[model samples]
Target: MGTFSAMHYRCLMPHKPSAHVRRPTPQRPMRVRWWLLWCAMWCLCGAPALAQPAPKVLRYAMVSDATTLDPVSFSDIYSVEVAGSIFEPLYRFDYLARPVTVKPQLAAALPEHSADWREYTVHLKPGVFFADDPAFGGQRREVVAADVVYAIKRIFDPRWKSPQLPNFAAMGLTGLNAVRQRALDQKTPFDYDAPVEGLTAIDRHTLRFRLDKPDPRFIFSLTGTVAAAPVAREVVEHYGDSVGDHPVGSGPFVLASWRKGSQIVLARNPGYREVHYDEEASPDDAEAQAIAQALHGRRLPMVDRVEIAVIDEEQPRWLSFLQQGLDLVLLPGTFAPVAMPGGRLAPNLQRQGIVAQKLARPDVVYTVFNMDDPVVGGYGPAQVALRRAIGLGYDNDEEVRNVRRQLGVPAQSLVPPSTYGYDPALKSEMSTYDPARANALLDLYGYLDRDGDGWRDRPDGSPLVLQYHTDKTLRPFNELWKRRMDGLHLRIDFVPGQWTEQAKAARAGKLMIWFLSWNASAPDADEFLRLAYGPAIGGDNLSRFNLPAFNALYDRQAEMGDGPERLATIAQANRLLLAYLPIKAHVHRLQVSLHWPRLQGYQPHPYLRPFHAYVDVVPNPVNP
Candidate 1:
């Protein structure tokens, strides 16, 4: 039960020092002369002594296994974090910089935008090569502008059915939509070779995009690795429908080995283009300044390998980090008190030289009322009243204090703080909690107790029961909700299932109500607002909310720059969402990460996926 023994169970290689052998010194002058002659001969040969290899593996754990490796096929945060290492985007947020700044990753520099914001031109960096694979036919292919074009075209293909297609579809590309419709109508495979005037490759390294309408935030969309990463045509053709299992990209790391539902190993990509660690931290942050000084000019991918174990339970994940079986762990809210008592590092952890990084994430968790479900769905006055009543009855402030342990902020609107277009001064009906008003609304909207059953019946006199889909992990929160619903005489039932299953059910419009969350992919409010857009119903819009007024405001704000006009449009959209009550926005959870002192250059990014290109691990000394 020691740390080293625990590491064996997690498939980690423990250090074993070499045994030392000693020889007696020369006792006589003759023996001394013989030893002196041997030393002289050894020095003349110029041989080097054996030394131990430096530690170069970063072992970590995740709360759940990644569902897919395809960058565009899934929208989950776990999958996106893994795909980010295998795929390279045109731009990425700087690792140590505050206030989120994007810098060129695969591109040579920032894209050139036209005055009207309808055109963008990007130039790829030379010498970038994809990982070696059988699909290349033993030929080394360099990344080109056509590769980027082909990747974007795959998103529009019906066969792949990328979940992030709406992001590109909203751009109003000149001829892209027509090609997509043709493929859909003919029931044939998409033509990747077909020339789309809107997406053109001017040269081997230059790619240009032409939009029909003005889009100031179009550049931010390209920063996502899911839709913007380059994909080789031959790789896709060879892998066919199983392309997600075989990811090949020009990134810092390549998928070396994988054991599904167990562990994943990533090794440094030898073919990756030359890149170095360079960033600026806040002037007042001493810890950040110290880390920057140590890794300012080092070559990227300081670690030679990365091993991630799938530890679904929080207790084991926490123990793994405590025992040094894992290098990093994001502390769960339930264990915050045990790990960082009173919002400070625990005494035992501090004695062990463990460091904790706290951050306010740009994310929101909410319960979605499926608009397609007859029980809890619609924009009518009665449906809105019911949803508002439930929203008001379920006190988020209590949930934060009891369940979250004061680790989150109660959300006022869907737009999280620190993002563009977020209005801190705006108040909405869902932000308030009043059980008295909730009871009155339910009673006035036709829900009443019939036959002295103690439970209220639906307006149509059918047995009223609201089914909520959730997992065992959220039993505490579900119990609280059940108690609140009982006070209103509303019967409730819990549907227990895994997170993946519930996500699929929600997307298929089979669930009545479900708890879900969204983490921002960019610093703009457009990323969060587009989740409820009408065109994204089958994709990011799990609630299936479709309001023409909200859509109009969303579209208008998409074209306007960050200013008073755009802020006003965003406020209008928020009002529409609040009025309809498609979802009950909950809270913005705080992120707390714990790691060993040896793990340096560790920074938390609200939106950017963890790439670990600049992270370096110092080796611990072996016991003698």
Candidate 2:
């Protein structure tokens, strides 16, 4: 599964510091002779004469506060990005590889699979130790095969209610689902000690998994940071529900301190295993070559520390990047024009030696209709017609041009570009904008402007009003939606709420219409199709779409390898989704990230969470 971020407008808020903040000391101007004398003395003294401070720390800014440090508890990109540094998945994709390649991280090598493709055995690298924590009784805890088993089992524990349970359940792991059901039926705590035939610790260094069926996409799940990362059992037993607040792992960085919504500090893990930075970049990529030249062969985690501040509002985040308060910033599409005018770097930023990296994200942004809601729910022809009309009325191309500033491509289907199942040749009903056709469809479905109130009424003659759940951050987009709906005499009222609150409401089926984006975690089409799977409702399937045909096709595709058969099934699934109109696919976003010249080896992976192990901080006299 991929990470989803609620689509909303983040208003630019003015940054205000605390009243007790200290002012910096003024620098006195020195004479040219004095400066020349100091330089001469430094040159004469050579390496031992002058002492330099340690390499600079990496200061990054996040748009919102991470909801959790517990990997499986939440699926938000922000949480994944933050927790990823502290956790290590068994396998990770190469940083600069074009055709994504999985490389072992915590595992000694890739898993060896059985002939039937139902069993997988992984061997762990020795000497990997967890960060020092009070939960370990002042002793270093080496990550072992049992730690991996414990981590996977936690997802099945009913008490945790992990959102990733569906992904694991789909694996058809023998005896695991039965255990989850037994615990739920008895209303008792999950028996962590109970043995499941699927998961086994063959030895201190080897872990094995036995699935009931063949699933070629199973390895993709292992590459994700959520269920694959090893977590110490003692630490979870100590912190319990509050484990998100305290994270201990064997990664390049460890969480030093986190102040809720304010700031986060991560220090280099002193006990981390020795790993070096190395990568092969494409010969055509000059930027990659430049980064490789500056950082290749350097020890992992080139920076001493990583400090991140949560600035939910975009204006302050952008200002911080401009004023040098932050070393890197992920520019939102709303502020793309300000940062990169006409799809080119701003002259001012270029003059200041700042670099902007732009790439097409392997993701899709769309508005989902709650299939459980009374007003918009059901699979009847009338309901489907109403949804199709609404989708046709809203102009995604216009939104991309005006709101997104051409920073995205109008989506024809749920699957975004660059993914295995995405079909660029397929044209969808939602991709067209025909107001007359939309109005005709509504009229045919008995939806008309009754009582001459200038708004359509339901078939039952009740007042029809679509309550759109959104945050202040999405005010601009909502305004555009209102205008579009008004043309068809459809009323849409906005219900303002925070991203976190709206996300909770969405999961509870309390939303009529909501906008969000899903970024793929792997290169497979399953990541996108899983969002509409019937069984995934209330989990990744926020829409609660439960079409039986779509569900069957989803299952069929899951069982097949990545081939023509899988692609054919995927096409069938896409057709069903478009026909049902459960979601109005909007666009695939383009990511534009900005960073200082001092920050090197910064490559953006569309699917991979932020990994700073290979990043270095070079001294820049001009920026300093």
Candidate 3:
């Protein structure tokens, strides 16, 4: 069967041309108009030139589907990936800038802060309009400061059950948490109409944010982040609970069609504001400079449409990419030997104009030993010993060499590479592999063979079986895990399940253990540390770790500016994660993105997700 080119799928979605359509001549004056039109057409162009040009389409694939399209409620990278295309944040990362510089998107400029750094004032660019929607009574609606306020308020509203409530509230937004508490305590609807001193719309285009205390890096929350993208209040109220299904935004693309878990298609927002390509590049960066020079004056989102398919497995996804069904794919490490041997693109692929870019991804793969599980969970010395031993037995280096094909480094801390608070010099037991010590610890903790069954038993003489929940993609990793647990003489079971279902189970506190990775959304370690924060149990803190001392350290670090004091406090939190052993941190992965030559000016930003607007589709006839 003939599949796609993104060209094939674009035809399946609705076509709403953003460009101006030509009006025909009037009825009575038709003959005269036709004569004049023909004369003008003859004078201006030939028959071949009269034909309309095909719309440019870009295509790609992902391993998983987004949890939700709702901008306010999602925490997973997949969901944010979809939301990033459809929503517009106040600020965005500079497309080609190294070190990831934050520049204005909807905001006129960066905010001005008060002397004490407790307040920040931002002015929105005038005439920025939202895409045409029913919520605006069939009229074009310009985005204002109030829309941003409403977006922020939605996170605090209890009805939404947003996972970001703890995150934004911790940013020192003064009345944000109190309002949420009031709604919960009084059992009333969240009062969005009520005044919030911390988040105030000064006027139609100006917004002022007042915080309870100084937060030097709070602006990072506003830059090209899904949490900072503003959705219209009218759209939310009109759609009610179904707003996620009907995402209406002023971003470069509009959600044209969604086939739930199968495919996602987006059309260029014809009504998108007039913006031009003008990204920054370093002096020595030839590739970025060339890309910027070529695309400098073009209108934003050079592609006319985008199609992303959900492809789960490695071999099929790789073959699809090779066959030109998809223009770009995040190349899995399993195929690194074939695609880029010795960290260089193979000659055959290079001859086809296939480009490869690799980096040490700013993320950490970790196994969560659920703190709520009876077998794996507890704060006591015996339980701690069991977790620590398990952590010590598994070798991250082996996984990197044997499983990952030397595409990653053994993770030393919860904080990922290139982010603040990641002390490479600081050592911990997170990556230690000592079977002797692990065996001793297991024996001392009473996790042993009482019935002489070869496998270890619980302290109470019950069966000590560990139920590990994971998706099929991690089967190789799971095999290594099984072998390591065998060394500890511990019995374990692998329960295979879908990512979406298993994630829900993990969040509901029903899973004993699950392996997952957390990629950095911003250039901050705070995102990683949130996994251990007491209040984030139902959110990013999948482990449900709730230690008072650890929580205090997290809070203490958050309150201070980016300096030695904050770094010291963050260090304490990292050490505490090791002591508690709620999670066994593994390797920081190496991300390899392979794309065909047709996808122009494409480069993977370390953490930035919304990059469709920055890339263009100039089809290569040679490849086709």
Candidate 4:
């Protein structure tokens, strides 16, 4: 474990107001000469002769909305990403964007394990205050050892409603036996059960954690935004239902307000401190330093305010930035100015001294055909026809190279080649979209236009009507699918709504086809295969693809521990999913995003979301 610390010193320097010492009063040439000298002095010292210097605020926008504010309730990347900005965990990843070491966040030092690796001890960082204001009946006080104990307990508290309970139980912590038993036996009220027997307060600034087994990745899990953060125990106990909607955490920003589907505002935490990296500098030096400065002892909204206005449509988000109303915007690469028709967005940005960046996002999009549905049962007549239709339906290569402008690679498998355990050969096995083969297969399958109506009918005399469910988030992709599927005699009906609703329809077997993606900032094949092929992991597994063989393989991979053997098992599972054809990976779109001229630092983090690791957004000019 490496200590994360920063040096602080107060320095008083000369300054002059650049605006007030203006025009030399237009009274004398001598005065103008003196002004030039003063300006030179300001530049040399990195300060103005009569100007005050201070921190600035950074404003940004999100294309997608956060599903839940409750950390323990869900583990979706989007929610976690937002949570990362507002919460603090015990440790984080290194500059390589890997969880190379553990550091203290709410804790003062890295945890120490006993000889058996089942027992652990940790020291808490003293004087860490919650963001809530004490004057408003809120407890804005230093963090204590008991807070950590409470947080770990809440993860398994049935009444607290944490979605991470199962995962927590999987950690095999014997100390939580009492908590689990109490909840199960109804000894404690639904939400009042405290679950850990090993968490004890050595002092106000120290805590100890004892586990039942050796867990090397256990510390990394503490880096997670949800379960690892210590919330205000009093606020949570009293506020109850309102805590999730308005959380009080020990981070740089506090929940100012949320208007639901409209906007969420966060004011800076005055108690934040700039922590220094150890003697060695991490590769994320630039971004890490900026983020540290912005969070520690910085004034709110470096300027007057930082606002994220809600716009349902992506076009307006781009337009607002084009007109200089917004500072930064993240949108799909296809709609980005460079990838847009006639180079629209790029030119506009250049005119305003702004830059448009197309970044390679670790996100993949696919169409999942429910293999377990009665109407779409695997190997059934209807299912076989549907699978054949997919193979001959769309020209993926053409779409990837021309329509999407190679902003993405033609996806042949769920896992991209860049990820661990992903096979490169899977790309060649994907469909080539030959019309002759498609027509012959359809005729052989009894999908013929017997009534001579241009659309083919099944043996049962019903025309094939494919209900394609997609969210409004990717309207462009949906439109392209409709146009591309026209030649297949497929009546593609598009339904655009919220993804959550679509997900519910998928799980209930109401959807014939679903277009969606699994986003992973860390390029791990397990993240993709585990969700797609494994027994429907919550909101994922749109296809309802349940294969005993794949499920067995997935379980074995998880149990195999961290090594090459696990990687091999994952590859086998992915291959099984591909052979079954429950999913058709379309294209691996490159992520593109833009920022205002004022936003100082906005970059991608390889292992996690940008908001998690290192990023800073400051006002254009230093605010006084």
Per-candidate TM equals 0.91, 0.90, 0.91, 0.74
Q: In model 1, what lDDT does residue 3 have?
A: 31
The C-alpha stretches of model 2 lying farther than 4 A from their native spots are 1-52, 621-624
Per-residue lDDT for 1-624 in model 3, tens only?
333445434434334445686545565675576577665654454323345778888888889988778888788888888788888889888878887888998999999998887899999999999888889998999999999999999999999988877678777787888889999999999999889999999999999999998877777888877777777888988999988888888898999888888898889998998899999888788989998898898898889988989988999899999999999988887898888888899999998888888777889999998898899999999899999999999999999998998889899988988898888887778998999999999999899899998989999999999899977888899999999999889988999998978887787789999999999877889889998888888778899999999988887777787899889888888889999889889999888899988888898888788788989887754543
Model 3 regions more than 4 Å off = 1-49, 621-624
lDDT of each: 0.83, 0.84, 0.86, 0.61
Q: Model 1: clashing residue pairs?
A: none
Model 1, residue 252: C-alpha shift (Å): 0.9
lDDT of 4 by residue, 1-624 (tens): 222222111112234558866655556875666678666654554442455665444456665556666666555565566666567776654433222334466666678877766667777777777665543384457767777667777776767555466456555666675666666797565443343556666778777776666654456556544666776667676667666676767766666677766676666666665544331225566544544555544332233333556565767776776676777776544464353445345564556656455555556777778766554447565566666566557777776666666667777667775566666566444546676666676777777676787777766777676777777656667666776667767567887777656655665667878877777534456556745644443335667677789878865664455688887787678677656677877777765566665664455444555242233454453631
Q: Residue-wise lDDT of candidate 1 within 269-388, one digit each (tens)?
A: 887766888888778888778778978889888898889998877778888888899888989777988887889999988888888998898889999999988889988888888889
Better by lDDT, candidate 4 or 3: 3
Best by lDDT: 3
Lowest-sum lDDT 10-residue window in model 2? 5-14
Residue runs of model 4 more than 4 Å from their true location after superposition: 1-55, 75-78, 94-104, 107-124, 133-138, 141-220, 273-306, 331-352, 356-358, 377-388, 423-464, 503-512, 521-523, 533-536, 561-563, 610-624
lDDT of candidate 2 over 383-433, digit per residue (tens):
988899999999999999999888888999989877899888887776799
Model 4 clash tally, residue pairs: 16
Greater lDDT among 2 and 4 belongs to 2
